[model samples]
Target: MDLDEARKLWHPEPGWLNTASYGLPAEPTWTALQEALAQWRVGRNAIELWNESAERSRAAFARLVGVPAGDVAIGSTVSQLLAPVAAALPPGARVVVPEVEFISNLFPWLAQAERGVEVRTVPLEKLVDAIDDGTDLVAFSLVQSADGRIAPYDEIVAAARAHGALVSVDATQGCGWLPFDARRADAVVVGAYKWLTAPRGVALGYLAPGLRDRMRPDAAGWFAGGDPNGSYYGPPLRLADDARRFDISPAWFCYVGAAPALELVAEIGVPAIRDHDVALANRFLDGLGRPPGESAIVTVDVPGAEEKLERAGVRAAVRAGRVRASFHVYSSEEDVDLALNALAG
Candidate 1:
């Protein structure tokens, strides 16, 4: 979809600019959720009806990330999806991550400490150089959530490959507005609420064939089976042959809400959305007399900026002691000016 076409489908009030914390749902996503809830409230449809939406969301996520549908696993959260990868690590495996990385991508590896797993946290700028022969995995967010710095993806991947280490990316803060291809990493995980515009309970994960083979499907249930509908009562212990084996039981309502949002993102196309978001972010920065920023999320150190924004009815976030303003598909140049005017006042 074109930018204007996609913009009209969302309903964010003017001056809303907090997509970094959570997404504002589009009209289609809201409608799908309401319809699903209405059916549930009256018991008008079977619970299995909800399952289809999860599968649809999984496929849509796969398309957005440029991966085969079978290579994507449906999940409820980033940490939950990363568990198997952490479990599969050998005792004393060394993982490297950015010091200020979002906890979802860091905690899972840190939790492996009792198993002799060692997590090395370094500054984001040094992440690529941090990978060496001893590093077993290099995990980091594609975009920093606190300040919106895009990772040096090519350098990081090259460094990891040179050392025979695996690369895992948390795309939670980057996906919908950042153009990326999941094939570039060993594993890519996305918590879609922030930018894909889904509800809070859904996540999408991509596992390379080798990574999936190393990881155990410890969380596997009927949902992970090759035929979930038939595997409910299995003694056969059937699991999907690919990444679906890593699937967790889905949150029905979340998927019902996620499908349309994921589909909408795929239809709008990330490159176009990235242009729209970054242009607005640049507009905001220009008005502030600052250099243009590449990422859609911008952070500034104006004193009391957070309080100023709040007082002006401008929705944004305070992260790591800076006022973070994020633009998305729904944001416009007007939203950018509103925030700039608030900071000026």
Candidate 2:
């Protein structure tokens, strides 16, 4: 689907500028969720019906990031999925992260300090230069949550590779509207609620073959079993042979809603979404007398901007003492104008 056709899938209000916080669900996604809830209310079919949604979402996300579905894993949150990696790190290993990185990517490595694993916090610009033989892992957000500054993906990945450091990216802020090839990093994780527009319980990740071999599936359950249907109760400890081994037992209804949302994103295409969102962001930037920014999420230091937008019925957020207004494929020129007018007023 083209941008024009895909824009019809959502019905966002005229002044919603908070896709960076959480995305409003598309019509098909909302409908899929409502149907699943209704079915649950009456016990309509079975778990298999809901489970199919997880598989569909998994395959769709895999296509969006250019990796095999078998290489992707399902989980509830970024930190939860990364806990095993943190635990498995050899004692005294050093990890490099940006000082402003969201805690989901930071806390996991910070927790490793008990074992003498050093977690180095550098400015985003210095993050690439920080990688050396001493750095065992380079972990960060692809897009900063506070200011929307995009990370230097290719540079950081290259530096990590040159130093033999594993790269872990929290793409939660960048994925749905940004084109990413997950294979570039050892582990690329996303919580789909914000930009992918899935339910809160949906998180997806790609784990490279080499990295998958190193981490245990700490949250594994029946879903992680080699034969989930046959191994309802544990005994032989049979887990999946691929990245599926890292799976966390899913929240069924969440996956039901996620399937249609992620599939629609795939149909519309990430490169197209990137163009649509960034164009709106640049328009907002132009109105604010600032140059265009690469990210759909933009931050400005207008005093009382949050309160001003609130009075005008335009929804936005304040982060790091700046108003963070994010655009999405569903956002409109009218929405951008409303926000601009509110701030100017």
Candidate 3:
């Protein structure tokens, strides 16, 4: 796939570099949404249609993250997706998390304290070292949101598994721009609004077979069952055996957008996407006279750089006392040039 396909999807006026905060949706997402609205206006709202759309989205996410569709769950947000996971763990279980993490990954595990579980927060460097035989869960972010630090997550995952601890990852910053295996973690939670280029209000989750078999479906609902159809008319509660048991009903419009967004990403493939983003990010770092980093995020420690870049029509953000410029598949060398010149100014 060429940049033309991505360019035609969303055109930010010029010098828009804030894609890490929120991605621009493709034209197909809009068209699909309008079609859904039209169907609703005509009183043709069908539950079957919504189910089919959600299935399409689940399949796309599974393919993207290298998991089976049966292992994927749908939710409105990453926090919402993770709440059930927190509730399902045994009481008094020791949970290890990083001191620096996006709150979505932090709060839920911390909230488990009310259930008598112990939550330990350590520095990201010591996260894996903190895990032991007594630890039941390890929750962390694959990419640090503030400073763009990509953690050595595979080592952590292996350590957790070796210690018999379940690992849950908040992959919001790293999911679409990079390739990751869902099977590596017990659970992987993601919000689609950022790197995935879908709208807000939809998140994708993956539960590994081991975790899926062990945890109870604490938040099971009408749609969170083996046959939502048979469950609707049969027993009061008959949940599915797979990850679908954790699936919640999502906003239909979000699914309309997500299906196309994920399909496009799948067509482009994450390997190619990672290479493209890394190249652009390295170019941006080099342009700023900084060393190359591993991921698509480049953070410069220049004073007042965020405001200066903004005034120069280059979009960037100040996070943790550094100017963070996040590159994506849609970013071009021209965008980096504009940003470098603006930084120099």
Candidate 4:
């Protein structure tokens, strides 16, 4: 969609925060959410009815990420999905993760450490190296949350697969803004809250074709089992063959909330969204007024600098005398201009 059309869809009030950390969906999110709530109330306590909506939401997500619907598992949280994969790993197996990964990616493996699994924490460079044969699984975020550094997934996947290691990605920060090839990894988990603009308590897990069968469901609820045909007794009790087996306490509301947001994203196209975000990021970067060597985002180092920027109505990180201003599709040129003028002042 063109900027003017896109602007009408997103009518953010002045002074609203533009942090992608909280997640931002396309303009139709509110309308979509209202519809979702209505459907959920109508289907409450009806398993078969709810599954229909859930399946539809899965298909929507699958299309968004370019995967088959069968590979998608709807979850309420990223941790819920990652937990199963972590439990299924061989005991004492080393799981390599980046030193700077978000806590969501780290906690699941840390839980494994409590179960006698070896959690190997290393810098991003070492994590890359450790994806060799001895590695059981390698987990990392597609984008580093703190600095917005995009990880090279192709390289990481190539290294992991060469060693026969499974690769799991926490794509929370990258999904709506980046092109995510879920088919490229063993499994990828993401929350709709951050980038997808869906309500909280809604997340998704996309398991590569054969990987679904490998995960031992960590918290299997009644909905996880059953044929939905009534012949099955006591909720079937067996995990599903598809990614749906990973779901716990099926959330119809979250499913509903996600529908419109994803629909809008599909309409806009992810590549177009990325281009807009990158342009905004560039504008913010150029406003720094520093020499090329020190113009990098997230590298500024001034005392109490982050607070100062915040007071100026700018969100940024100061490291090594450089200021890193994160920008998103909703961020206007005026935002960059303000930050630049503040630096000049």
What CA RMSD would you report for each candidate? 0.9, 0.9, 1.8, 3.7
How does each model score on lDDT?
Answer: 0.92, 0.91, 0.84, 0.70
lDDT of 4 by residue, 1-345 (tens): 564567566654332234445655554667656655675679645555545656766777898888888788888888888888888887788889998887888888888776688888777766677777789889998876666677778889999988988999998878877887888899899888766777788888898766766667767665565443442566336666677667676576666667776666666777877777677666655566433321112344445655655767766554335455555556677766776665555
Error of 4 at 235 (Å): 5.9
Q: TM-score of each candidate? A: 0.98, 0.98, 0.94, 0.85
Q: Lowest-lDDT window of 10 residues in candidate 2?
A: 225-234
- Model 2 steric clash pairs: none
Task: Flag clash pairs in model 4.
Answer: 23-194, 299-319, 300-318, 300-319, 300-320, 300-322, 301-319, 301-320, 301-321
Best-matching candidate per lDDT: 1
* Candidate 1 per-residue C-alpha lDDT over 1-345 given as tens digits, one digit per residue, 9 for 90 to 100: 887888899888888888999999999889988988899899897577688888899899998989999899989999999989998999999999999989999999999999999999999998888899999999999999999999989899999999999999999999998988889899999998999999999999999999998988988899899888888883988999999999988899999889999999999999999999999999999999999989999998998798888888899998998988999999988888898999999
Q: After superposition, how far is residue 58 of candidate 2 from its true place, in Å?
A: 0.8
Clash pairs for candidate 3: 226-240
TM-score-superior candidate, 1 or 4 = 1
Rank all candidate structures by their lDDT, best first, as comma-separated numbers.
1, 2, 3, 4
